[model samples]
Target chain A: MNLVLLPEQTDSTIWQINDARQVSHLKQHLDVKIGDQIKVGVLNQARYLAEVVEIQSNQMIVTPVEQQAIPNKLPVTLILALPRPKVLRRLIMDSVTLGVEKIVLLHSYRVDKSYWQTPFLEQLDHYIQLGLEQAGDVIAPSILLEKRFKPFVEDRLSVWNHSQTTFVAHPYTTDVMPINFNQQCQLMIGPEGGFIPYEIDLLKENGCHIHHVGNRILRTETAVSNILGRLFCA
Target chain B: MNLVLLPEQTDSTIWQINDARQVSHLKQHLDVKIGDQIKVGVLNQARYLAEVVEIQSNQMIVTPVEQQAIPNKLPVTLILALPRPKVLRRLIMDSVTLGVEKIVLLHSYRVDKSYWQTPFLEQLDHYIQLGLEQAGDVIAPSILLEKRFKPFVEDRLSVWNHSQTTFVAHPYTTDVMPINFNQQCQLMIGPEGGFIPYEIDLLKENGCHIHHVGNRILRTETAVSNILGRLFCA
Candidate 1:
């Protein structure tokens, strides 16, 4: 029942909270009070505990308690094969919560053409907002769309070639994926059925290390989170 | 497009494909036909390529091609707080695909009481079967339920608590969770909002080490998958 959120702050001294939608949410969903202390942030600014000073029909005012420290981001960039729309939403939210700096949604052979037509791409800002609200962080990760696999691998991937490490998550491989903290990393994960042998070979040929998490295969979203978690720890 | 899945059989002459629902899945969804080669598995035997000989309404019969060796399971046991029904299904299936040998679903303070009544629990066998089918494996992991957290931690946790190493995932913790595995270990993850401070303290007092993945907090299911992926790799 945590109601603290960022991007809700309107201004300093006079915190203009006039969001008719949020007003209803505060009144009905969260039962917020005039004097209740709520956690809030001001887009990339410090998070503060604010005491509600005033409440109007669609606006509210609050005073900040204290400035908070910002947390560092994870030292990895994730390149995932665009999954189904439903799964993509969860992946985007989880990636933000896990503190990834960049996310590249690439087209793969197994990806259905219908996934690209999802409204989620148009509502990318909304997804970012949901992530920021949950993580209590201000910085948003950059999301990139790579439609062609070969060009992305040959052209765009070279920029990240100097990364501390590069990993391709494929289940068919026997080699284990290792997490090394010596440098920044770029992690590539496949779609539902995983990358075909030719795609895998292209990644391998272009300096990406093919790694396996285990014998069993996982879904695209689960594999993304799992790989990030493991890599962060390693 | 790679159909090498049909050339790994060796010993078995007859492939008995039971499970009525799966039979329908093969016929309708996969559009599998007689004379079509598909990947199949024998009970605890090996994954092999099989050519469909008989496609009945309720079952299918196939002949094997060659035998493939079985891979080892991940070296960690996951004790997860049972999440809501929807998340729980994904967690169970993902955990299996990640190669876990055993899983224990424990009740935690953050778990909603209503989640216990989900129809997914009754269809647990089907969920496990889905995992096995995806991974092309024969052996299924054992699933256990602990309705009470305290008693389970007090009575049973000690027996399972080997110096093999135990970890409890928590946020805002000083200790970083280890990724490298030195021996067999047990890892526990909390529910959606995470375990209450009291539950965390109790688990810590009972010989579990409290460690965090990173500063960025992750969802329960994500944390579980990540922890297992990292631990098993080491």
Candidate 2:
């Protein structure tokens, strides 16, 4: 974790840490001691320098020293096909670390229905919390679950964020993504087996430009990070 | 697995499959039947369309139908600091799937010396084979191990492949990678904790221009795929 992100404390001057993971990390990895200064940030807020005021086996306290500038999140909304439960955990964390603004998990032809039934989807907050902790960012990206592809693409996508350039990653497309294409991007990626031709046509009709990322086939997790990195990680 | 890669057959027209994993994948995933055509590639050679000539419980035979086009590998070379054992296995597979031409696992100040003792390093061919199956490519990138950083940078790196544009990913550098930068790139990435100031200085002195992805710190696996995607995915 790059920054220690905590929930908004009632007293802005000092923050208390109670989570065991955070406490252990502080003690073991950081070797944090009283009067030690550490980089800290509040959830969905600005970063700051905080000095350790108190330390104990179960709790620690820190007081804000100075405000620090917060970097802007990438202006990209990701449309991803839901992956298996194991991959989803890492995917959420990796996406958050990449600083994506929003994510939509869409149902697709190849996506297993059992994946949607996983308990992980029901308690998304826990997963998002893990991602937030890994990224050291307080703000969580809003996640939308779309179980119906046709309605979502035909009825809703047209009315959604069209200001951003829309793209759907397809293997057959000869056109490569333009370098440093600076614009708010809405990227759609398919599941492991990829979208069928009919689904590709539906996405195309909705104003998505198809782009290819070389010939080698990538797993969904790798593809998501790779696409985001290619599009926005300048 | 996209393409079933096999050793070169002296008969030049027929190939036999013996691996249980490959047989099961073909039968269950591809649902391949006798006379069915499948994409096949020879190790480090050309791709071809092959027809299943015979099938049994444990063995199968395929005959070449015609030669197929093989996609070009990405022209980038990667220099990575050693990661932990588990991450290293996945890292090698992910890098190969992303089409990197060469990899150098260099020792650094932040790298745990114990990581060098992993048994997986000795069985690297197995991991590379898995990556080939995932990407449907046959050629494996040559991996070089540099246990000493100072001598590797001062004595070896200077005489090595300097033709490619050299860049190291650093957090403090404000310079973003150039857009549409078309070149055979040599990218250097640090370990989980990142390169210390002294190591960064040595890299700079050896002609590595520093670049930053963004403000958010990324884990080593995420950083590898993200950096590759940013550099050559287009």
Chain A vs. true chain A, TM-score per candidate? 0.88, 0.94
Q: Give the number of the best model, judged by TM-score.
A: 2
Residue lDDT tens for model 2, A44-122: 7767889999998999999999987766677888899998888888887788778778999999998998999998887
- Please report how far candidate 1 places residue B70 from its true position, in Å: 2.7
User: How many clashes show up per model?
Assistant: 8, 0
Of candidate 1 chain B, the 10-residue stretch with the lowest lDDT total is: B1-10
Candidate 1 residue spans exceeding 4 A from truth: A1-3, A8-10, A14-36, A54-61, A162-165, B1-12, B16-33, B43-46, B56-59, B162-164
Off by over 4 Å in 2: none
lDDT tens readout by residue for model 2, B23-59: 9999998889999999887888878899999999988
Model 2 residue pairs with clashes: none
- Among all windows of ten consecutive residues in candidate 1 chain A, which has the lowest summed lDDT? A1-10
TM-score of model 2 (CA atoms): 0.95
**Candidate 1 C-alpha lDDT tens digits along A1-234:** 223454644566556556576566667766779788776667666667778888888777778876665557777788999988887778888787777888899999988888889998887766765676567676778999988899999887865675556788887777887764424788888887789999998887888889887666677767877777667763
Assign candidate 2 its CAPRI class.
medium
lDDT for B53 (candidate 1): 93
The superposed Cα distance between candidate 1 and the true structure at residue A205, in angstroms, equals: 4.0
**Alpha-carbon RMSD, candidate 1:** 3.9
Please give the lDDT score at residue A181 for candidate 2.
63
